[model samples]
Target: MIVNLTTLDQDQAIEQISQLEPQLFGTSAWSPNAIRQELNAPARTYWADIDPTTTPGNPVIRGYAGIWFDGYDTQIMTIGVAPQHQHHGIGQTLLQQIIDQATADHAERILLEVRVDNTPALTLYTKNGFTRIGLRKRYYQPEGIDAYTMALPLNPHTIGFQPTHA
Candidate 1:
């Protein structure tokens, strides 16, 4: 089942991330230092797939998602599902979990930058109610590619926040 990403799972996440490095930041591989840096970043939230306690088949650590807080709003740091695990609703599941947390943290909105070339991920965010707010020129590092700025309004129901009168 899906759950919050853990500090103990850093090693496994790093290893898995290495395998998919080519997908992001272009063909240049990432260093262990980079992986550790990401895992230990301040004000970051991460979620991971775990070994199902009541099910069969190797859990294999499907994927992970993360976000960084910017005081006023939360910025989506990164989100990815293992290639074999794509299209199984894992992306949506991970995103939902993060959205829940962000809203709980009192974030008014969630923002992210995605490569314009990433059609599937863009579609996924769009389908999940994220709207394109603007464009960032050469936003993706190492690739010098533009990214679409996406924002998702956090509904109170999704994060269990109820307002009260003074």
Candidate 2:
């Protein structure tokens, strides 16, 4: 069950995501404070996939994703799934939800950076039509991992169309 995260889910989201950060992002995981700030940031949307079978009072976040949209462009901020829940389509679902939002918001394009070594993520993005646009050397920080800058152009007419005006 994918749901937009609310203020009430802040602490749980932070706690759960923090637990998965090291495994997902290596040395570049967001701190709890950073998560809090992002959640409060304007023009950003965050969502979580909750375990529907969990007890009513204790919803478990199986995966979470966030994106920042500033009218014309949407930038993916982060996406993480609990290690145990990965490979079960949670990440894909989160990705799709954000993409849907970007399309509905009239975004010209959506962009993101993924570690070059993250094959699963690269595959996921590529399968969804994102194309590599550039590379950011040593973008993953102290770990020194390179990143691939990828983009998905939402409006096909704007991205590759060269209109020959007669």
Q: Write model 1 residue lDDT over 24-118, tens digit each, in one string.
A: 44544467678678878899877776546634432356767889977668899888777777888888888888888888888878999999999
- Stretches of candidate 2 off by over 4 Å are 156-166
Minimal lDDT window, size 10, model 2:
154-163
Q: Candidate 1: worst 10 consecutive residues by lDDT?
A: 51-60
| True lDDT of residue 77, candidate 2 | 97
TM-score top scorer: 2
Residue runs of model 1 more than 4 Å from their true location after superposition:
28-30, 51-59, 155-166
Give residue 98's error in model 2 in angstroms: 1.0
The Cα RMSD of model 1 versus the native structure comes to 5.1
